[model samples]
Target: MSEVPTTRPARGRPRDPGIDARVLPAAVAELAEKGVSGFSTRAVAARAGVDRRGVHARWATSEDLVVDALATLTANLRPPLTGTLRGDLDDLVPDVARALSGQRRRVLQRCLDEVGDAPAITERFRRDHVDRCTAVLEDAFHRAAGRGELVAATTPARATEVLMGSLLLRALTVGDDAVRGDALDGVVDHVVALVSTSAPGARS
Candidate 1:
């Protein structure tokens, strides 16, 4: 994988890279500033100080740019499998909550609020982001079950949905002020109680 540059050249500083380094960062900055409604190729190009034609040449549509940006947004969130379900949740849950806490939530909320107006954008957001997140979080429970950390199979799916729903709601409504220690912790304690073995960390 080609390294993504961590910092953009100063505005109008003349970068000669593939513009990937320039545009993706610019897209995120643009998203944070404008939400989804105001996001456009022209706007992102201006933000990156690159020609709009180059952006269009790279990402044929705004949806493409947004999807690529979404990919980078969660690129660092690798799941933790420490053999104990509670341990895994303790680590994974907070990281995910923090990811949802700031501009990430803005991306989702904006796409969600005007889903009909931008159906393609919204669908891409869900497919690229929401659904991908659900898959990772839901898998943690199954891993726990396989390791005999769950007593009764009380349906991890419902608990997973509840966990995700609560987090999304909290992030959208409450924002970062509600986040604590990188763990927004929406229904997390309840979900843990519902799915954990009687011994908490015991394995069969």
Candidate 2:
């Protein structure tokens, strides 16, 4: 008799499993429209059609809710990695810069201005948002290295920081509109050139 194969059951919620799932988007929308300092759980509840207590039960505080919701929204909008390290950075950097054109950047700036003094809130932003972005870039670089596009000594973490940090500064300055296409393309070409030249055989 042939043995029947059994597949493992899927783990965790298919996606978002929290009670916050329903209200999370609304909370993020409120923060984007109103800024972090201006958000109210009651208002979020009204928009989400759930009671204020429901939001509180899931997120506990306005800071927690806003941070988690924004993180989720940002995650959804991240650009796909284009396989090669340079291509991936090119794809990601401009889209990230473009995201500043939205209301979300105002929310982020407001949070920084008001909650910068709050260690826990700031830490959560660093851990949840900043680290995740860094990780995505790192993973892309690692994939390129596996494909022989990255050199043996070019560290994914260090290279990712340089690319992402530079783009963040540019985005902060660009503000209110998409980054100029020429400048964005210049960044991508320049970074790709640097990485390609750093690879072992490119110069020879």
Candidate 3:
């Protein structure tokens, strides 16, 4: 007798690409509004206008969804390149300041708070947010070097650290008002001055 062939049943409707687009933004909005403690798959599904099953199908848990959503948001933010290092760095300051404050800040704090429970989420956040930011600055520095605008001793990582650290401090300690005011301008000016001073053939 010939062997019989078997076929498995389909696992429900095909996944919708548009659902992902809607769900990611909805997840971010939910986290911004409700925080980790209040965030739920049901709420995200409702917000996205997708079936709860769709959300669960894509993500195993609310934490997973949150991590993915935050990653999506961070990945979309690229530092502007204005053909000059100072111009590019200046262009990035306001956005960096904005990210460190407001709803984004609260969402970040909540992520930190939940790190013990979701270490993977923390790692993903670091890779998605911190690493990407560093990469952008590093690229800018390399471009400056290629243009002979940066000194041999200038370190992209160190410069990124200094600029980001200062902005974070201002955002977390002095508040967003400082970030939005002349303080931000002062910080950008200081970084630019430091870079200019350290550049090749700069006046001491």
What lDDT is reached at residue 197 by model 1? 81
Tens-place lDDT digits, model 1, residues 114-202: 67877787787778766777777778888877776676755567657867777767777877766555354535676777667855663
In candidate 3, stretches whose alpha carbon ends up further than 4 angstroms from where it belongs are 1-11, 14-17, 33-38, 75-81, 146-148, 151-154, 198-204
Candidate order by TM-score, decreasing, is 1, 3, 2
lDDT of each: 0.73, 0.68, 0.76
RMSD of 2: 8.6
Candidate 1 at residue 171, lDDT? 71
Q: Which candidate leads in lDDT?
A: 3
The 10-residue segment of model 2 with minimum total lDDT is: 195-204
Question: lDDT by residue for model 3 over 115-138, one digit each (tens)?
Answer: 787677678778777787668877
Clashing pairs in 2: none
Which residue segments of model 2 deviate by more than 4 Å? 1-22, 32-38, 47-49, 77-83, 146-154, 176-182, 198-204
